[model samples]
Target: MEESSALPRISAVDLFCGAGGLTHGLVRSGITVRAGIDVDPACRYPYEANNSAEFIEKDVNELSAADLRPHFPDGDISLLAGCAPCQPFSTYSRAGRSKKRGLDWQLVNSFGGLIRDLQPTLVTMENVPQLADHPVFQEFLSTLAGYAVTWSIVECSKLGIPQTRRRLVLLASKLGHEGLAMPEALGSRRTVRQTIAKLPPLEAGQQYAADPLHIASSLSETNLRRIRASKPGGTWRDWDPELLAECHRKATGTTYPSVYGRMEWDAPAPTMTTQCFGYGNGRFGHPEQDRAISLREAAMIQTFPRRYKFVKNGDPVRFNTLGRLIGNAVPVRLGEVIGKTLIAHVSASRGATGAGSGNAQNTLF
Candidate 1:
């Protein structure tokens, strides 16, 4: 480690970068996020608008190292950052989810190929903790043994995100570093109330006229009674017998109690999923409101800024489209921690090198 050598500045390209969640965090940490690449056309507007990074709409499987090289310089501390879409491993989608012909199953391999070809200075990936046991994840790891790598299953609540999501975060460097420093925990967890208390409230299935994105899906009459019976953090077991779903009334349905429940105002919300805007989806119902958590609230829980516009100028905000983009994003706080860790690691390495050089020169004299 030579003190005379300057630390390399980081530049990154985010693959599977839906709505620029990771990019925003990297940018905030002062990394030059060159671009965000995703296959979803719905992601372009928000990714471009909220972050200074370019949005590249393309399938990562189809991307070549040649396609990615032009975005980064010939030589620098370039980072290939990605959070490959994680639906196949998701518990919610497990009912009928199959790996056969699923595009997501192929992405980890594609990510490996890109790394093999580009050989970027560093790599970082985040995904469901379940990925560690999957063969695709093992294959991805096999490609990185030449580099210093470390990964852990992290509790998102510890990282200041207002949700109880867990993820597998991995970092690797070819620059003589072996692993990343884990992000420190906040003094206290942020709650759903802390994240969305100030936003204007909305009625069921109503849009806040002033801010269209601050909207909630409507509840059916039966759902209305069910929600009314729902105590904060309580499940359908608390509902009146008349309102219980047929499945719930059966002996077999006792284990699925988190559905049709309400989030507690003082606790972190449950993981935001693609259908989080629906009343019957998981525990998405609002703590105090008579409706499900709105899109804006859901985004805020994911730690997206309040003003992040998910829709284009004339586009309508559809649940499935925006929900997928939002739910699939890496939490911005986690990204910031990752970005800052890289910076600190590079800086420390430079300082250590500089001190070694001074000692060597003294020895020579």
Candidate 2:
């Protein structure tokens, strides 16, 4: 029976599963990701192709526990993972606003309600660090008081991801006084040069012939000249007087000097946003190339595997659509850490139960 019986596993569903970044990482750590739910139809190809999970192209607000139950298996620990769109909570988006709330905000509430209804054995969520400040977040925390909740703010670069992003990672379990711990960091920081140095070089607006996605966005003649003058780790202040944008002369624009800057080769990249493919957005210019980083390069910085196909063959690689997908994704390496942490918790719980029963051999990790 030991040979024939299935090993205990945690079955998971990824909510708002953009391009399956988190799902891919968790799957790598031995979790059975049963399905991914998102309203974006564009995510279907990558999410389904990269993992053995069904893709549900529907609004999360319309889903219920009954609808989700069929996706998981009959006998196993049930888990739910979600990272709702974090735009409203982002510092960049809320720069001048007094208040912000929208449909995406409601999605967070819906996620909490689903958890309350399903009462899964484990739950995990990742989002912008700013999320913890909002009233909605406080409401969400109230829902978790019944469970053992552990959350922390982490820098992605410390976790072996090349981009410099700060995020909130939360893990909750109903299995008695569990705490989520930060995964051990790489002894040294993972730098941009260490991540994307060896790929064949390409000019602005050029694509690698072997890979359709390894293409950079086109730069205008004026911006092209401007990029040439910009030094790595330098801002618009490095530019010639003639190449400066009109706003840069103003005090308000001086506050946003990181714009039109190049990334430092020896350091982790600035946080990639939806416009990471554009030269004027943030500090997205390539360290040496006179162009913004390519779509493939951005995904790699997000710690996705090199050959993780995002689109089908013969499809045109559209920049805007893909930029949204890659920028909003959780780093795959972080997801793998969460999976391993949860797995260890399950093992520890089983070991404690076995000790109580005086059957030391009953636990298996």
The TM-scores, one per candidate, come to: 0.90, 0.90
**Cα lDDT of model 2 by residue, 1-365, tens digit:** 33432236688999988899999888877788899988777889999888989999777787898888887777778899988775666544421111233465787888888888888888999988988888878878777767888888988888778888988988898886443565657557888898888777888999998988899999899999999999999999988899988899888988998888899999999987767888898888889989988988888888888898988999989888888788777888778777777776776765532111121211222
lDDT of 1 by residue, 1-365 (tens): 63546455578999988888888877766577889988777788999988777898888888999999987875557899988766667755521112232577788889999998999988899899999988898899988867888888989898789999999999888866632566647558999999999998788999987777888998899999999999999999898799999999788999888999999999999999878898898999999999999999999998888988888665688877777777777888778777766766666655632221011111100
Model 1 spans > 4 angstroms off: 1-6, 92-103, 352-365
Q: Which predicted model would earn the best lDDT?
A: 1
- How many times do residue backbones clash in model 2? 0
Inter-residue clash pairs, candidate 1 = 1-353, 1-354, 2-353, 2-354, 3-354, 205-217, 205-218
Clash list (residue pairs), candidate 2:
none
lDDT of 1 at 274: 77
